[model samples]
Target chain A: MTDAASLSAPEAARRSLVGWLLVLSLPLLMAVMELSVYAVEPRVLSLRNIVNVLDQASYAFVFASAQMMVILTRGFDLSLGTSVSTVSVASALAMTGLVAAGAPDALVVAAGLIAGLGVGALVGLFNGGFVAGLGINPFVVTLGSLNICLGLSTTISGGGPVFNVPDVFSRLFYNGKLMPGVSIPIMIAVLIGLGLYFLLNHTTFGRSLYIIGNNPRAARVAGLPSRRYLMFAYLACSLLAAFGGLMLTARTGSGEPNLGGSLMLESIAAAVIGGVSLQGGVGGVGAVVFGALFVTMLSNSMDLLEVGGYVQQILLGCVIIIAIFLDRLRQTRA
Target chain B: MTHIVDRRGAGAVSQRALRGYARVGFLPTVLIVLVVAMALFVPRFLSVQNVFNVLRSSSYLVILSAGQMLVLIVGGFDLSVGAVVPLASVVSAMTMVWAGGAVPGQTGLIIALGVLAGLGSGLLVGLLNGLCVAFLKVSAFIVTLGSMSIATGMALLLTNGIPVYGMPKAFVSGFGRGLWFQLPTAVYLAALVVAAVWFIQNFTKMGRYLYAIGGNLHAATVSGVRTKTYLVLAYAVCSILAAVTGLALTAEIGSGQAVINGQLTLESIAAAVIAGVSLKGGVGRVEMVTLAALFLLILTNAMDLLRIDPRIQTIFLGLIVVLAVAIEEMGKRRTPVD
Candidate 1:
């Protein structure tokens, strides 16, 4: 007789090994491709180049990771892009107008980060209150929040970008190598990635998100506070999204109303491609990180090759479809 | 006194029936209220010219929602409809502009090509969605979500991200610009589509089958309704409707716009939901959905006239959609599980 339990452990380990291999393979391939394609400037493959890629990817990484939470729960927060936009705009306004009032650069940077965090928490509270408290569908609630967040951002900037923040704020993030060659942004990405990995893999709350995603009633029946965990997940997503917003502001030295226009879908596509199931409860931090890396590399490569902008979008779309198709096939086979 | 009690009890039962009917019919009333209110508040909002423009503008969404309502009624959803809208638009535009000439004065030929392209794309996407959902036992949400990206990517790939134009003006422009009995022809077409949908939903055997499937899938299966086939047909019809909407939109806009703007997805679902279509499925009416579309048009028109910020307008619409759905869900009594 075949025993189901006997195969479970081996099957899970195999899945994990396969998942890790799949996640790392694309970025590794891209690294090789980048080195070869830009061989004339072989230094382009140096540690500094790695730092630049990380800097470019950190904001996407954070936002995509946060969105992975929602996707894990078999829901999504399209409003996240707008949340980042809103927080950045709010932070910019605070740093430029109230907190700094032309104060020192360090003070301005500190104020911006704080404001971003605060706005993120507030947005999370609103989302959680409606979704968890009122029992509204996650899609509808987040869709409403997307509009509301965009409106808030517009109200702050009068529907335009807030430009010309102090250069020192940028220098803190955009400048300074954490090591001999690796930049501060790369350091930040590594730290955040590790933090997320621990949170999702080690913590009870993280596991609860999976439980709730796969079977909410079952979780509830098991005496798990599904609502509370859901709320926490939204809070984490909001906080991370805000952090991404802050990084974006620092990188650009400005806050723009439409900066997040393409972000919502891109993060979603990245998460899905990275093996984060839209039905939720089946992906990991590592998978999403790889997904973001893959997408960023794809776009960067297309740009480097001077592929027309439109074709790149189509290509990205195809990649997303293929990834999801593969994911579905894997699920069915497993 | 006894007789009076009997009459009062009968009255209460009738009132209950009316209230149930009102739940389904409330959206039309709201649409009327919005129109009347706009007429009173905004001077230009009620003008014949503005009415025609709004109706023309709303035609594509109305048709799209009508198609989507069928799928929703049959216990399914189609995220690919918005993707198909733009995809079809591009194909139709490209066919007229790049591929071949619609023979001069053979206006029928151009329209037919455009319609065929639209329907074909919709049919293909819908069939894929149905097959995945039914045969493979894949979740409808995931299947449609994947298809959405796939269809959208196909459009961008096909057009290379540039808008296609230079269509034979006769096919798109004349109907797009001309009026029928003092209203845009598009408006009449929209009305015709809505009426047809109403007839199908209210009068057909397929409609009953859909409601049954939505109400209880297992029961429908047990009853030997060939549930999967009907489900596929439902999606096919929905996609065909979406195609019509796409073509109408292309005609209205006079070209293909590949960027979907995410608004159509929200608005189509919003219109269906506000019309009392339950997300859990097996409920709603075509007339109500048409009214829901008109209602949104009036609300949007009002906001524009009031000079409300575009972001605020979107928020307001989103809020209304959420509230409408929440109210519907709240009114419903939960069914007992087996």
Candidate 2:
């Protein structure tokens, strides 16, 4: 059940039990903190509050999962916010017509998913091609792509939100309920989490990704298509970003051009704080999910405590610095 | 055969330089061509007032690029520059606004405060970045990326997510209004900073160490060069420059805005890298960076004149960046990395 059993000895041996413990302990500690806060503010333990937290955190989960891929590849994608905007706009446009045509609910959902995934793959291919072919740094490549994506999204949407998403898809994300009173967005998060975990650990491609991230040249010598793997990583990131955007639109019932703006840094912060090394080749899907959830809970707790925005941001900053410090400590230990 | 081979080798050397100039100098060349082309085709391109306008718009960018260039030269980056300057500027401006009502002659005093705050903020962050990389041995990318968040958060914290303005006339007015020879004092200050950077890069022992470390870190360490100290100094210099840029920005805009860092961070990095500063570090000129900034200014200005959508303009910039990287790779393959 732990998924630790599937990991090869070389990988497991490289990471001591302490490294593994830190990974699990950080989340547990945060959960404890969450519970302690709930003790003082009993309202936080309410089903509605948990539902709200999960619903709000679903988008972050998606974006952070995408960012985790890039980070796992020993790279980062700053264009994700823009990609989300672009994909959401595109998907909204796609969904509008599908619903208007009276398409089947399942068909509408499939179309939206396909549109998002396709846009994501296209954007990722552009980034991966340049990064792999020209040897441009991922930072520079993604930075450039970020602007381009933003510009494209803005142009396509004409500097406005793309609204009127199909009712069928929206219901799947927002209106659907699970287990009597729990919301459906939490289910989406779980599905994404499970999908990413399987993709990251249970596949040869994922193993190759880990190897390539640790050392691209070594991976290439090991007969891995390092370039193609990097491409897949970027593609996977963009697809997740697009999915996050679609989910955001579904939850809100509209595709805002800037819906996922702050999610960019928040996603990176969550992943980095959750113990995803920016250096690549380390971290798991579970860590990324926990990272996103932790930040979401922090924000929720702060809101419940009536903490002002400025103070909240300051606290967030402090948390980031501490997380980074811990991450550095962990890396050195390894 | 020997004579023929010599001639071929000589021909190859000059060809290589020509290509280097094209790859490294592409933007400036394009800038010069565009300037000349515009001056010839349009009546307004060469007027003194228009030139002054370009310079005024470019002044803060010069300061920003100068700060960024030092780090670029040393094979590191400071993504936090965009956030740091805005944070410092907002903090200083908020303090100025608060002080303007309490005392006379407060504006001048606050300007000094702003300068000190800018320098102090840069130095602190830069030192933090340096320590993370040197002592903690974490990568520069992570440290700076983390700093970007920290600085932006601090900025947001300073004002509770609101813009701070309405400062007394005495503080920003002088620097904002003060002009020399029909040009802003800010432009002059930027010029001074640029000159200082040019001199430091060309003449200082520290500058040499920067190049050495960038070219080969292990070699520099083996040669007994205290690289960590130099990297710390480099980041410190970069941060101070960012602070100055921020101060100048506040003077120009007359207020502090948090949203400025989103894309401008990459712009400065792009301008620095486009100036032919090797990503591997240790191979660039400050003059080239200044020229690259100028080129970007001209290009963006041209796009504005052409009435192109800002989004398309960004796409064009992305293409240029990709192409520049391609050309650089091709050049290195032809020359080899040794």
Candidate 3:
């Protein structure tokens, strides 16, 4: 691990400058989007729409952060979207089952939350056990787990939406606000971002992940518990995904088997666009926030422009490619 | 290489032969066991009609897996193949309809135009994927993932989320459902593709180059192999085969739908890997992949016969994929370097 203090003053300053630029790029892009959309449709610039974009971006923020953790350890979790679906379905079923059994609202919510998080943790264990413990490729393991989760979700939900949660659940979790104009989801996203930032930058486990991702051979030679750290990374990733799914379940007031439509790709797109390298050992919470915001704003702006869903999807695909291309260019130049 | 030569003694040779059999016969052995068990337990499992049904359904998978094997051999796997299927189907179907309407009776010309358009669309996507992955140095996974989204969007946009109907009756019947012998037309098509792929893998310089590239890319580059061009070719061929499967499937179903064959990409990869195609690349056999496809189809067919829940079947499929890969990993660990 190269510490910032070891670098010369100019080098440190230049690095910080680059970091600031990367962090600023998304807001800069969002500003440009605002200007362009204003020229086309001025109504989209209203505070209500801005808040709507932020609210939607909250989900992306959480999902992107989850993806970032695994990518930091040089792993890909293709199962994230399906895991979210499973969590949604599992938690929803648990809650609904509890509700039918005459459980109190708080107990129902707590059990549902625990069930969702538990499913997420189990998926993480499955993936981590294969990839970290058994030395299988993360791609194949996660792909297998994706299918398993999809199947499990559909089976548990009976291939339909699980509905009829207690009204109070959504009221306190998703709809409630900490202050005026600040929804619970937005607050949760912010808290998660801060927690992840602190953990990644200040903790031994987080620092060890970076080291392992940078050079697994070296990390192993240095006697770091690389496998355990990798396992925790995947666990954290899936837990965050489950948390996002729980928020979504609250908002929708249902457990949706198909809840994760296109989110797996979008989460990766968000992280990648936020300067998170797929090769790993780089990126941060700031990048993830900006990336999530940018993706949300782009979609929101396109929606305001009345672009069709299919066309928006096409544009998003293009965005992913272009982001990766630019990242490659940056890598080569650096 | 030296180990095999040094182990020329009678006992050593038999041991080596047994190990080789275990390596090469894993899929076939499982397939045989599955067939025997299904036949013994399931009613009508051994019926000729059921066997043909399995073969007919597996023909498309076999074709797709043949292409997937090539890409895997060349050190990349495509997630976009599934999207390419629907995109090709929609484009081809729409082209045939439009051309038929314009010409007012030229069936042959219309079919030609439709096939060309569908293949052209596939080629374009393949080119995009190849260019990005080979020239721009993007990860094949991300590139294909993006292309998958793009192709899917294009398919949906072209059809407005509706299935394209009105394909020529002759087009659907002659190529899609027509049987030369007792087998479905698709079975013949799949066989032809398998033969073509086998020829490419066994007899062509491109095949050897692909293996070399996959086995050790740096070594291949050092040895003057044109890695970039071959990589593009591999991807192009893979997508083109997927397009072929798409066209055939459209013919069979008599419509072009955006959502059709959504599972082909993963299933094809699964088939190839289960047949011993290494995800790490530079391995696999066409015959084995075909057998693996057949095995999967039979497994599904048998489960359906036994009235197993489709959801449980899906879970079984996932477990099989993971188990196959895990077994391969264990086998690799047990084997010493030659």
Ten-residue region with minimum lDDT total, candidate 3 chain A: A1-10
Docking class of 1: acceptable
Off by over 4 Å in 1: A1-52, B1-11, B14-18, B74-76, B98-102, B128-165, B212-232, B259-262, B333-338
How does model 1 score on DockQ? 0.35
Clashing pairs in 1: none
> What is the Cα-based lDDT of residue A23 in candidate 1?
42
Clash pairs, candidate 2, are: none
Q: Assess the local accuracy of residue A103 in candidate 3 as a C-alpha lDDT between 0 and 100.
A: 92
What's the C-alpha lDDT at position A2 in model 2? 20
Give per-residue CA lDDT, model 1, range B282-309, as digits (tens): 9878887887887888788789889998
In terms of lDDT, the poorest run of 10 residues in model 2 chain B is: B1-10
Q: Quantify how close model 2 is to the true structure by its C-alpha RMSD in Å.
A: 3.7
TM-score for each of the candidates? 0.87, 0.89, 0.95
Candidate order by decreasing DockQ: 3, 2, 1
For model 3, what is the error of residue B328's alpha carbon versus the real structure, in angstroms, after optimal superposition? 1.3
Name the docking class for model 2. Answer: acceptable
**Model 3 global lDDT (CA atoms, 0 to 1):** 0.87
Evaluate all candidate structures by whole-model CA lDDT and list the values in order: 0.76, 0.77, 0.87
Give lDDT tens digits, candidate 3, residues B137-165.
98787788889989999999999989999
lDDT ranking of the models: 3, 2, 1
lDDT of 2 by residue, B113-187 (tens): 666766687778788877777666766765787787778878877776677787555445677656678897778
Pairs with steric clashes in candidate 3? none
